[model samples]
Target: MYYVTKDLFFPPVSQANRDGILAIGGDLSTERLLLAYKSGIFPWFDPGDPILWWSPNPRMVLFLDELIVSKSMRSILNRNVFTVTFNQNFRDVISNCQNVKRNGQTGTWITNDMIEAYCNLNESGIAKSVEVWQNDELVGGLYGIDLGTIFCGESMFSLVSNASKVAFITLVEQLKKENYKLLDCQVYNPHLESLGCREIKRIEFLRILKSE
Candidate 1:
């Protein structure tokens, strides 16, 4: 494991441990966060823990062509029950993600400092949000870093059933329209896999991120 200093740098991704933790104890400055995302690294630590940087092997990703929209989701999309928008109410979207409870999770990683840092990134147009609304209420949404052709998804929340899925499906369709190459999901989860996200070698993911 490596330790980050104030110099705005990270060790090579190759040095990461088996669990993909490359470093610890870094500030969430905008510059540092951007540098980390551009290098295919991201911070994921418990609220009380110091910042932890990871670049996991077998990275979880969703290729635009591989996205799976289930029959039920297709029916939902066709119904037009939810209104989806991008970069709308980013603060609320992320705040909801921070507060929403998840199964097997006792606390949130989206600390106040992390929220502030990502909000700064959003204002600078480096981070983006997708919000789902039923009427005027924001029921679900997600936020992530926009690395040009690749989007590094950070977190998502759903206040109602299938709301987050709607947001995700809409985001993927828009990204496909824009010719995005990939959506970096960071790690594997059964939930994401059900939506067509799959694991690829970390080196392969890095190649895609670094490619022009």
Candidate 2:
């Protein structure tokens, strides 16, 4: 049920038929990437694979005001063992997310092409990163696109246990400080749920999409 667009940069995919996948095989040009973000879709494919866009049935999102910090996490935050910063080292954050050992993944979908694409987006001010450091050593962090009031979280990695969680908590705290409405997690997982993420229908999700 996906529709194809004649525009080379915009694959033939309709909002209604995302199947979670909205399109396949397209360049991540700034204009197209921006359009995709504003419409609640994003590209996710590996090297040698055609660009694939997805908008899952039940999107995972976190309301910045509702972030549930556990008592243990609250204790850690109060300790302030690590400091957090924004856009201090975007490349490093993305690189860590790619190279860090994930639970089950062997290689990474954050291919060179994806790196370059997101880097380009970062340069244009649509994407950003949150980095965590312990005594000046980069430990954990994450990165994503910022469409005005919506922060679309892409990925995160941790060099130390609880470090990435620190980064996530910091990011949410900052977003709340800035009055952002939503943090799009894209897919649902227990890890995110523990961090206070919940599912909402796609129709509900688009209502938060930014037009600009």
Candidate 3:
């Protein structure tokens, strides 16, 4: 565990504790966030808590070629019921993700400061968003940092069943076309696993993360 200060620096990822918390207390400036992501680190802290930066040992990632699209998802894609757009209405997307209530969590990690920081990244074209619309009404969306080689997926939300899935699947397809190295999912969860996201050793993740 490392305690960050006013400096814009972070310790090596190898020094992180078992839980992947590398360092704490760094400003969410666009420069720092970009440096963290490029170094295979990301900040995830609850409101009122000090900032926590993480670089998990078994990092969850989606290899572009290994994305799993279920038959049902394929059917939905073919139906064309929802229209998908990229980098459109990003603030709305992140806000929806911020407000969504998860089953195990009482609050959102996407705090107000986080919204402004990432939105700054979006304005600089370093962050990107995917919007899903049904008949011109936004129903689902996702946002993340785009590193050209890798996309660091932060969060997503859906107002209806399969809307977020639609956004995710479409993003995967587009990323594949763009020849992105992989989608960095950060942590493990059933939902991400269902989409063919798997854990890789931190060393391996860093290798790929820097190979670009």
Candidate 4:
């Protein structure tokens, strides 16, 4: 059962009873968004779709220390192919992710409302971006929310070959530097598996959310 907020804008669904949906139809206010993140829920919906929240059962995450840089990737890193930065050109990073054409995607989930919401989060110091640049141009990057000791990676895109990988690798290295414990990837994919993401029960994930 989903519980509606006093304003009839937000839902109060139990984390354990997400039903693959934590909430529906709510404005992305700072307070509400913060509360949602604290409870391991996140908003994900299309432009015309109502605000849909999700909290999957088996959470996918990557520990900074557990990142696996394959031999080939290691070679690329060794050659110092691309340079990376953090919290710089966040809007550009997300814009690229949203507009870049992919193999099987017709459009992006990063609606204009979503962009404004996240940019607000960034201004409030809750969300951030990692950028990969070449020849002083933004080639690839990723965006996410950064809790005290956790980074919830949302999405990434690459304009040049392996550019996204470079951005992600830089993010992990920086996380290690900051002593961050985990990078929440949200879902499982072969690419993430190759980069060392693993699955954990939601209960355990919530514990980390609390501890972090």
- The most accurate candidate by lDDT is 1
Question: Residue 148 error for model 4, in Å?
Answer: 1.0
lDDT of each: 0.95, 0.85, 0.94, 0.84
lDDT of 2 by residue, 57-98 (tens): 789999987899999999999999899999989999998999
* Model 1 RMSD in angstroms: 0.6
Q: Estimate, for each residue in 68-135, the C-alpha lDDT of model 3 and write its tens digit.
A: 99999899999997999999899999999999887898889999999999999999999999999998
Q: Candidates sorted by lDDT, descending order?
A: 1, 3, 2, 4
Writing each residue's lDDT as its tens digit, candidate 1 over 100-200 gives 99999988999999899999999999999999999889999999999989999999999999999999989999999999999999999999999999999
Which residues of candidate 1, in runs, are more than 4 Å off? none
Worst 10 residues of 3 by lDDT: 1-10
Q: Can you write out model 4's per-residue Cα lDDT over 1-212, one digit (the tens) per residue?
A: 34445463434334435456776666788777787777788888787988778887788999887899989888988888888889988899888889999887788889987888888999999999999888998999999998878889999999999999988988898889989889999878888999999989887888888883
Q: After superposition, how far is residue 159 of candidate 1 from its true place, in Å?
A: 0.5
lDDT of 4 at 121: 92
The TM-scores of all predictions, comma-separated, are 0.99, 0.92, 0.98, 0.92
